[model samples]
Target: MPGRDPADRSRRRFARRQWARRWLAWRYLVAVVALVAVVGGGLWLVYFSSWLSVAGVEVEGVGLLSATQVRQAAAVPQGEPLARVDLDRVRARVEALAAVRSADVSRKWPDQVLVEVEERVAVAVVEIGGRLQGMDADGVVFRDYAQAPPELPRVETGATTGSEALREAALVVSALPADLRARVDHVEASTIDEISLQLHDGRTVEWGSAEDSELKARVVADLLAARKAQHYDVSVPGQPTTSG
Candidate 1:
């Protein structure tokens, strides 16, 4: 027993060192598993749990359209996690309405989705197939009316609604001053370069092309103010010709 004592003591120390290393390795693995569980649980709570689900929706910038209409159009996925809502799809649906010009959709966090929309405004009216369609500044026929609005100009593009002539006519109609615009009965354009305006009193003005339209608009405004002619030529605005 006395001769083998040092060998036994050295073996005990070696066995203790091996046990310590194994304990440390097991502790590290347990710590890593715990950390992963905590993070995964937090992510699931935020992304997939009903705690953050959309409980309601808010509609803004609704004028011509009722809040109910915009909300129905948006159709924000109710009871779904707010973070998971498809904003682009919601906006596209809202914009599909004939009255909406643009729309924005966003998550309001916790429990709501917000939808903001801009409604289209009529700059002119065009009669097609015996029905009146509202025309915006961009030449889009976005709305229809049972009867024509008295304030806006009537665009006579014939049966063709999508053409360069329609664009030119819309430009001319939108650029008129309040004073001149009120007297306009209708605007007729066969081509982009040949535009004419018919006043309420049966007077005609040749507005020519859309080029230099702002300058021509100003010139026409002044000439109409200073003269009363049956037929006025503002195609060459600088040197306008007039006849009764």
Candidate 2:
């Protein structure tokens, strides 16, 4: 081996260099092929594959509304790509139902559309056309009750009372503490500024505007607990008075 020619050694070294260059080129080619395969597979899975298509709709957070009702309202097309479903459009449709205050629509990956809804809760009932309508805390009248539920307070509005007055009455009722609110028989709103609460015991509370309602609620509760009265005047909560 020590007697090898220099030209032979040079030729062997050159052959090794050529082989290494070929291996480096093959590595780049394999990497490029792998990258292309990954990109193509991702595109097919998201846009052209049926494996991730919508198969059904799911509903949540519904009490007054049935899951079937919410699904129908959502109107999510069966077999459409789940990633392609328009969530905003679905949400708007679900919210169109009177009982649904708001809704959130989303894709439950792989095959379902999810609809979560917030239903309106009644804080009081109002008589409109001899039918009792449930009113939420925001004073939006919705849902007709066949018979008034005993737990919720009623709101009595004069023929001249407008929606604003009814809103004020709702605010006054909502401000009262639960224990105190339970004692109220009904609320009367002659005008936005003229709100009153009538108790079941033939007693009345002159509640003024919706302003200072929290203070007024506290004052009325304290006055009732401290003394027996036929009439309570907490219109000016800072200086409350009562009379029998």
Candidate 3:
């Protein structure tokens, strides 16, 4: 056999080096794919297993509502997967509760649900069908009336029984000045077309419509300030008359 030429030997060495480089490139790709598979498998196991069950529920920003009541309102079951919980649905349910003004629901890592509730602050006591109840600005009755809340107004309206009436009355009460608000004794909404306010000072404000309550309240305050009178008739806008 003839001995190999130096040129042939050099060429063979170069080809072997190229083959080794290609093999190493393939090995690196396999290693990367294997690592990704391992990580994906681990994550799938953790997500599918019962390890992420809800262990507890946390409530925050609650004042008028009790923790138990808030938890009941949320209605999120323990041991349920945190991922499966519907935060928006829970928040909507909580808001449906008469006492809750607004609600925020979120998940805490791995094992807890965080619920923050903003309770409705009572603005007045409303009389519906002769039964007195406490209500907030959204016309939701939260509690039965007792002695009137100090510094809060009393709203009485024929339309106060339903949600629409409550909403209108709330808008009216919200428009009153804070100082005048405490002075208001009772508000009467005897008809959908008219509303009247009774002041603690033995005066009555004839507020015919819920429209422009803010403007009407301001006018009423100005009249009361101008003359320490007993009654104001503001059913007609831009022309207010007072009586003593």
Candidate 4:
């Protein structure tokens, strides 16, 4: 075997040391990445853990529903992490409550839960069992009339409570002009084919059926505009017009 030069030997040792250093650096980098991943995952798991009790609850967009009612509706356990709450179930439960038109439930990170609700808007007063009750657009009768709103129209009919007649009456009331709307004393829908309006001004508007109420309203408005009329017959929209 040939003897190696001193300079060449030194150079070879230097290269081997450099290679070892590079290898150690790569290993250190890999270890650091793995350690960081483990720590990050642990932190995330701890933050989102369902077993953690909910620490906070925020209720928003509630009008008819009280904060206590909203909490009861959401049914989220206090001190439990938001991740543990069933958002869909909570929303469904809240919406099922009377006057709750809509609801949304969400998590607010770590330990907070949020709930939002929309309350129904009462449109008219409906007569049920000879008792006047407040009814919303969705045909939900939510309140018994101790005192009339005086602003909303009244619905009177022989039709059974919770019938389509009530719904039709609600639609008609919702379509009337704000000024004229308040003057409507009551809407009668004894027959599905016929609906009538009794104005507070002691005028009668024969608004047969809830169909084409906008057109009927326009025609009636025109008639009322043309002259001072005590009664209007809009049973036939464009065919024959009669007024008194």
Candidate 5:
């Protein structure tokens, strides 16, 4: 065939350019639609879908408390959106149990609420109303003991002893080293500032206040290792004294 006319070729080229422009416009619209669809789908799955809702609760770090008890305390809403669950509220509820010292609540994806609890550990035992109560290092009287354990030292509070005194006594007991603690028979607190420890070997340590407890413990340990005495006064750790 003879060479095509230049005008005819030019018109075809113009038409192709218009078509390319229109395709570009449609491509932008398609991309926007796809983005909206993805965002909407993600929102639905996270906020309203049953597939990601809570199906069960898992408990951990429970010793004194049963899993059932922790679950009941948590009260995590079943069938609720896991992403929408209030973890802080769940944690607060679980920690409200007297035996639970702290708790962590989290979502296990695809349908589980995870609750981890740190339970109170007894550092000493005290008698109240003819019943023995377990006291933690923080001086919290948490659990009642049916019978006091032989390894745990007892705290003896006199009529003048108040809550502060009990706390001071607890601090004193908690500050003792393991070997010293094992040797402790009982602690007596007449007031917040007057706390003493009686050892199994019939030796007494007069420890004053919860302040400077670490220093007092060190002094007591040193005195016991260097001397034999029925009485030790580390109330002033800087000037410790011992006498028979």
Candidate 6:
């Protein structure tokens, strides 16, 4: 009884080894659990937290359109998660504005969304119902002006704008030389084939169709140089005529 029994010593050694193995297994399990918790918390913080939520909106390339107007039109989800914003939907809404030619929406990260817009450039004006419509080269009546723009030529589209006749009128105005364009007072076209340019000097040009407009422009210059007529019919560039 004074010394430890061999069997008792062997049983104690086995118990110690078993306890060590259990401790090692528990350590591995605890480490794995902590790693999983850290990963889950990080993901939750990134994807669903206000730390990455949108806090500000930036609008660029706004000239004809006010920045406020663009922001209103964009209606980007305020305070939404930055990584979850629908950029394409915002872009489409911004482009729906009458003056916006195109739009690009993107996330600036952390807390901001940016919307960039390209506005339509007006080349002509049309008067309808006492309001002036600014017309781009594509014959789109984009915006209404309180008054007619003095610098741009006028297109007489009667009751409506952006019709085929309006397109012909736009083409005619866009093709004119700088000097000739400056002298033009207004363009009138009842039909696509009946386009005409009325000069600021009271001289009238009978431009028949949208076709051969460049050639007709050149021929009209030559014809006007040769005579001082109030009416010039250069619709047929090959055989032009002039009369009072």
Candidate with the greatest lDDT versus the true structure? 5
Worst 10 residues of 2 by lDDT: 42-51
lDDT of 4 by residue, 1-244 (tens): 2697989988999999999999999999999999999999876666565555587678998776688888887777776555656788888988888878888888876577788888888899876777888888766777677777888788787734347777777777777878678668888877656678898878888887678888888888788778677778887888536567
- The segments of candidate 3 whose C-alpha lies over 4 angstroms from its true place after superposition are 1-18, 21-25, 159-162, 228-230
How many clashes does the backbone of model 5 have? 0
Model 6 alpha-carbon drift over 4 Å, by segment: 1-46, 159-162
Over 1-244, each residue of candidate 6 has an lDDT whose tens digit, in order, gives 5698999989999999999999999999999999999999888877798889888889999899999999888887778888888899889999989898889888897799999888999889988767899988767789998888888998886543347788778778888888888888989878888888999989999998878888998999898888999999998999999999
Clashes of 2: 0
RMSD to true structure for each model, in Å: 4.0, 2.6, 3.2, 4.1, 2.2, 5.0
Per-prediction TM-score: 0.79, 0.86, 0.83, 0.78, 0.90, 0.76
Error of 3 at 216 (Å): 1.7
lDDT (10s digit) by residue, model 1, range 1-244: 5667898989999999999999999999999999999999988987899999999999999887899999898888789988889999999999999889899899897799999888888888988778899887767677789999888888887544356787778888777778888898999877888889999999998999777777777887777789988998889888888999
Best by TM-score: 5
Model 6 residue pairs with clashes:
none
**Which segments of candidate 4 are over 4 A away from where they belong?**
1-36, 39-53, 160-162, 227-231
lDDT score for candidate 1 against the true structure:
0.86
Q: Give lDDT: candidate 2, residue 147.
A: 91
Please give me the total number of clashing residue pairs in predicted model 3: 2
Q: Per-residue lDDT for 214 in model 1?
A: 79
Selected candidate, larger lDDT, 2 vs 6: 2
On residues 23-43, what C-alpha lDDT tens digit does candidate 2 reach at each position? Answer: 999999999999999999987
Scanning candidate 3 in windows of ten residues, the lowest lDDT window is 157-166
